[model samples]
Target: MNTRSGLFAVAVGALTALGLACGGAESVDELPPEPPENEVNFPALVQGVVNGWTINTSEEFPPIGCGAGSLINQMRCVGGNCDDVGAYCASAGATFSDTYWTSYFSEEGTNYRTCSAGWWMTGLVCRGAHCDDISIQCTQVTNRGTGSCRWADRQFSEEFPNTYSLPSGWYARGLACTGGLCDNLRVYECQLL
Candidate 1:
């Protein structure tokens, strides 16, 4: 071969020897690629809560007698199906005619209940308050629709973050949730106040 061909052959030989000396490792291009980020598979939430209320009560005054109901509770439910709660409140002298039913949504299910202690405003001392600033966040997989996923008097829930004093109270009227977030909470003060 000519001088150039000889040189080319020597260079090729040197490259092969260098590769062997370097453990013959493949370049980075041969490695597997990295997985993507923020890839959500099932239903989930990055922040905030489901469609519901917080029901805040100050340290001074909190709920005493609490009544819960829904579409399918242990006994009573929504829309005039509160015989259980009604009996409990009546036994405690809390008039059902003057009370208000509070409904809130959650990841588990929708909550339906009556607040009499601080909310009924039945001439009794304000036992507590219902603030809609509940900060509950979560993500899960379910067969629920993308909307509010809320049913009527069919889903019953107890409660959480027990920040109250009494269980039952007198009664009141006209209180509801405006569907707001934690920061933009809705406070239903005692009607007497």
Candidate 2:
């Protein structure tokens, strides 16, 4: 055969030997399938109504995340002899994150921090504090909220202690103190998403 025809014969022979000639290639059905286009990646809810807040008297508890549905949006303090810290949670449907310190002004004032719309009051942290000082520990889902939610008119203290369970959707969200010890507490609830 001519040189060009000889090369073609060798090429065809190699392809035939390797089972890659013409229809010898793999069919569409025989090929591996492609991966999924849109995978579901979402955080799970901590099931049941359970309390996640704790009182750590010695040192600062690291900033914890919402292990479930919403995201911790803000940490705020209401003034007493010491400040009480409250957290605002927002829905995971949107991007939101922030941390700030609010000054303790007076005993008569009950500073409040509220969750935004479509967000739930998940839980809170109550650590020992000096004047205007807050040591936070954002932990678990201590209680489940229900019905229409709103802030309570009074707070927990030495006289009006948190002796009873939170009313309906109400939750203990903040803690005020004296002499670096937790004494007073605050409550509120929001529509959980």
Show where candidate 2 strays beyond 4 Å: 1-59, 63-66, 69-110, 123-128, 131-147, 169-183, 191-193
lDDT of 2 at 76: 39
Clashes of each: 18, 4
lDDT of 1 by residue, 100-157 (tens): 2122221122211223222221111111122221111111112211211111212221
Q: Give the TM-score of candidate 2.
A: 0.34
Best candidate according to TM-score = 2
lDDT of 2 at 38: 26
What global local distance difference test value does model 2 have? 0.34
Cα-based lDDT at residue 62, candidate 2 = 33
Task: Indicate which candidate wins on lDDT.
Answer: 2
Candidate 2 lDDT trough over 10 residues, lowest sum:
33-42
- State the C-alpha lDDT per candidate: 0.21, 0.34
TM-score of predicted model 1? 0.16
TM-score of each: 0.16, 0.34
What's the C-alpha lDDT at position 73 in model 2? Answer: 36
